[model samples]
Target: MSHKIIRSLLEGRLKAWAAARSPALRIAYQNVVFSPAASETYLRAFLLPAGTNSNDLAGAHRLYTGLFQITIVAPAGGGTGAAESLADELAALFPLYDRLTKTGFSVQVMTPVEPGPEQQGDTAFALPVSFQYRADTT
Candidate 1:
């Protein structure tokens, strides 16, 4: 499968997640999947308020909002496993994170990962995830 499919999936997933919590920003993530041939890669999702300066991306900021990063790697023939893990992580945060951030708050996930997919039953599976969030402050 091409990386574009995965990239689009990740962006849509992240946008839906941010919208649930921060309707004000109306986030639309930009995809940055690298090395299409690589089996594993990192995708970045950025959140910016609507009407944000197109020319001045990053603008000016003194505050150090914590960075949130989630990294998940699935073995060969396990793309579905990776996607599921990402879904769960966002699902857990979409509600509370939005409420907190709407009030001038900021948070970021530091490191997120999990073991390879674990089979529970003939038609079931479980994936692990590790995540971190820190409030942004200047």
Candidate 2:
């Protein structure tokens, strides 16, 4: 329940931001089929739940933690400049200690957004930017 709300809150923010970009970046959301045209750059979003644990003896309090990842996929052979720039923008979007709340659920960014090493493939280069998030509830 809370996990779903957390996902919605985070993904909604990403979706809104993408829609407002000048060229309107496309995002391949979870379980959605997205086929970008050749040479088109896009993003893929994933929510990886770390786990949930009871925080109190009576299980009245709980803690949820997870990693939210966004992968930037750009055409192959293009230097990493474009991908890196987008990564920077995304990192800034979810700053450390930021909080998103909805339906009585609140999730906080637990770490600075970190960009992983680039993964090169025949058709595209994927640079993943990820951050940790935590939520608490009673």
Q: How much does each candidate deviate from the true structure in C-alpha RMSD?
A: 14.9, 0.8
Compose the digit string of candidate 1's lDDT tens values, residues 1-138. Answer: 112332333345465655564222232134543432234323334332212122334654332322333333333454465557455765564433332332344343444433334434333233433333334332
Off by over 4 Å in 1: 1-100, 115-117, 136-138
lDDT of 2 by residue, 19-121 (tens): 9998999999889888888899999999999889997899998899999999999999999999999999988899999999997789999999999888999
**Candidate lDDT (C-alpha), each:** 0.38, 0.93
Q: What residue pairs clash in candidate 1, if any at all?
A: 21-98, 68-109, 69-109
Write down the TM-score of every candidate. 0.28, 0.97
- For model 2, state the Cα shift of residue 21 in Å: 0.4
